[model samples]
Target: MSGAATSPASAPALVLASTSPRRRELLARIGLVPARLAAPDIDETPLKGERPRDYVARLAEGKARAVSRASDEVVLAGDTTVAAGRRILEKPVDEADLRDMLALLSGRRHRVWSGICVIGRDDRVRVRIVDTIVAFKVLSAEEIDAYVACGEGMGKAGGYAIQGRAETFVRFLSGSHSNVVGLPLFETRALLTSVGVPLG
Candidate 1:
């Protein structure tokens, strides 16, 4: 006889292993509020010569593994990376760094890579990497300086937040918009449903 599908009530509660407000908000949009928030503390330093895609995937899985959870709880984690060619533009440390990142992205096409990891109650791990191509219009020196002065990209990857003021700078974007915001909704829903998380 075939195995029966897992019932929603029988599934474990979801634990989000991230402190990102954007991730939390995105989850709320799908009515999948997490049972608990477990921010994973780990070294996010990229390995020597690690590529952008690998970097994000490793971090997401690492975050999922770092969070403590009960056998009856599923864990979810995600990581986003902005890559200009092979270089990974991480969160800017200061205004100067933000300026530099924006300048590099000016009039250029870059890739936004978001990696999502879901750990089921049975300890099985599922991962998906979503890539979005984004192109920015030619930014003038004045524009970069003004945007940096606003201090919006301080903690955002690639020194910009797509859902904020930076959206005006985008000339073209092709891929999951939610992924650029921090989490990919379609992919996240699929992952959660696979683990028997109630989406409705």
Candidate 2:
């Protein structure tokens, strides 16, 4: 007797290798929803004297590689870095750290680097790095304290979230605004599309 016929193969699934809700939100803005969410737990520590751009790129690639999936599936990952000159500002571990980061960014132009990595079904990896220049207004002591008290900077790079109350502090911004919020939608969309991910 002949065996039951198998179903036709389906398109490769799109996996988002991140735990950040902001990224999912950003993807929603472009009407693309990941078929699966795989949060990779790879070492995110910066290498010895790693530049901000390189640091983000490495982490994004690492995250995309860490997720386990079928060969036909696609994985997407991203990393955001806040840089003051050559210094990389990571997420704040405490209120003091948050305050310090705010002070350092006050009335200064800093760089926000976002790296996106997309691994295709054929294991071909594509990366895009986006850099944004953000200028902060001169912040008063009260302003810093108030912002810190809000507790929005706890897990945010550079101890701030531009999409939140921190928007008032930005005097000028030159580049993708979405990058500062954790993902670059335009770059991300282009990367996914290039890798055969369907979008509306």
Candidate 3:
């Protein structure tokens, strides 16, 4: 009976520990399909004076572990941080936040950090971090106002979405473009592969 119920050599992996459509889309790009999606509710607040790299890494791991208890299946989780110096920027919840984020990011170089974690069937954990540097072209006051009015930056990390109209602001980029989008596929694929999550 147990043998009849078990799928061998061909079943898709466990679950994506996020509700983000972008993450799902990125996974599909590498042909690593998931059986389910888990939106783990975890405290995203950074500790007192936490560095951007540590913050992202902790968030990803926390999310992965939160979902691990939901099912017997392996879980994949990720987090992204946009930082200028020691300051970590998060998703904007309102217009003011977006405006401030855009102003801070204007005509400057910033670092985007993406942390990925996968909990394997063998109870082992694999993690990876991707860092990308992007420089934005100087933005005019009219352009910034218009962009704020577009309302695209709301709920987006660092108050901007590179895949959207904000791409116009990018004058130079070094490292994985996908990292800025949310997930870095190259690093993600390597992490998944290392954890025995076969990808086509």
* Candidates sorted on lDDT, descending: 1, 2, 3
Please give the lDDT score for candidate 2. 0.93
Provide the clash count, candidate 1. Answer: 0
What is candidate 3's lDDT per residue for 1-200, written digit by digit as tens? 34656556543376899999888888889997788888989999989999998999999999998884443467889999899888988888888788888889999999999889888777777888889998998888888899999988888879889999999999999999999999999988887776667787
Candidate 3 yields a Cα-based lDDT of 0.86
Candidate 2, 10-55: lDDT as tens digits: 6677899987899999999998788889989888888889999999
Model 3 / residue 62 / CA error / Å? 0.1
By lDDT, is 1 or 3 better?
1
Q: Could you give candidate 1's per-residue lDDT for residues 115-159 as a string of tens digits?
A: 999999778989999999999999999999989988889999999
Candidate closest to the true structure, highest TM-score:
1
What do the candidate models score in CA lDDT, each in turn? Answer: 0.94, 0.93, 0.86
Candidate 3 deviant stretches above 4 angstroms: 1-12, 69-72
Model 1: per-residue Cα lDDT at residue 42: 89
In angstroms, the error of model 3 at 199 is 1.4
Model 2 quality (TM-score): 0.94
Worst 10 residues of 3 by lDDT: 3-12
Which parts of model 2 are misplaced by more than 4 Å? 1-10
